[model samples]
Target: MKNIVILISGGGSNMAAIARAAQKEAWQEKRGLRIAAVISNQADAPGLALAKNLGLSTDVLSHKSFDSREAFDAALMACIDQHAPALVVLAGFMRILTPGFVQHYAGRLINIHPSLLPAFTGLNTHQRAIDAGCRVAGATVHQVTAELDHGAILAQAAVPVLPGDTAQTLAARVLTQEHLIFPQAVRSFF
Candidate 1:
């Protein structure tokens, strides 16, 4: 089986979606994929409990405990290496990794971002889309690169920005798409 290690910093909605997919018999028989471990940068993150509930191995590598981003990434990489993951999926992982770490993972790492990247690269994506009066807002699943939200696109799901949509409403609509596409992207990796 192809082992996958997923990293998360928050609620891990995407991680849950992918794990659910990995549990399917057809997915396992056809893709030969399994979620081996879940690594979180915050010990208190709600995702950790969710992972445990799913019976997956989990770890916490709090960034605040480390002296530098390099230190955190190095330790994180060490934990990940133990799993011998064929693929690493960053699902709501909030850390900005150093170029060296990104390079080390290279094609093995992938991420799901909240917005159509290059358009809205960082946080507050839903508010930004609303402020810009964008007709469309969506999510992108892509290879993780050294640069933030700059990577090779794998798949995207777009949600139309309705006329009456608030940032919260738009975000809710987009999140649904995120859950769908994120799992599909991970499945593609295998």
Candidate 2:
């Protein structure tokens, strides 16, 4: 069976959704796909527990323990390689990967960004979009490249920015879409 390794740094809502879909669809038996493991840089990340509860294997390799970005990415890559993942999914994995790491995964690595690509490429994407007075904000599932969020788009879901919407509210709506599309994008590879 082909394995999928997911990386997360926060509350792994997207990770949970993908795992759930994998379970419901029986990807292993049906499509030769299995969510082999979920790895996080934060030991206290809530998603680790959630992943465990979902019957998925989980691990933590704290980034704080590493001396530099390259060191951390090297260790992270080691942990991920253990799973022999066919695809590496970044579900809220909040770290800037080194170019070597990105090149190692290449087409196999993918991420779900909170805003439309080529627009908002970094953190605080929701607030940035709001501050820019954008009428539409969305999520993009794309390849993970060295140049931050400037990867090839795989799938997208756009949400309307309602009147008087704060970043929190808009994020909530966008997250709902993220939960949907991220899984869809993962399943597409199989």
Candidate 3:
């Protein structure tokens, strides 16, 4: 089976959504694909427990343990390669990947950003949108490249930015759309 390994650094809500979709859709039996593992850069990441609860293999290689970004990416790539991943999905993996690591995965790597990409491409995206008085904000699933969040768009879902919306409220709506479209993007690969 072609393995889809997910990397997460937080609660892994998106990771759970993709894992659930993979299980319910029987990706392995029908599409020759499966979620082989879930790896986290934080040893205590809550995602590890969530992934285990979903019955997917989990690993942790703390980025802090490494002295440099290059060292960390090298080790991370080694861990990921062990899973034989055909696709590597970054769902809340908060690190800025080294270009080498990005190139290693290349077309196989993908990410889900919180804001409509080509707009808010970095952290604090929701608040930025709200501050700018954007009437609409959404999520984008895209191919991974050396540039941060500027990758090729795969699938996107837009959510309206209502009046007096705080960042948290806006993020909640965007996350809901993320849960929906992320799984769809992954499924499209198979």
Model 3 lDDT at residue 134: 96
Model 3 per-residue lDDT tens digits across residues 128-149 = 9999999999999999999889
Residues 24-47, model 2: lDDT tens digits:
998989999999999999999999
**Residue pair clashes in candidate 1:** none
Q: Which ranges in model 3 have alpha carbons more than 4 Å from their true place? A: none
State model 2's lDDT: 0.94
Off by over 4 Å in 2: none
What is the C-alpha lDDT profile of model 1 across 1-190, one tens digit per residue?
8889999998988899988877864565777778889999999999999999988899998899889999988999999999998999999999888998898899999999889877899899999999999999999999989889999999999999999888899999999999999888888776
Alpha-carbon lDDT, every model: 0.90, 0.94, 0.95
Off by over 4 Å in 1: none
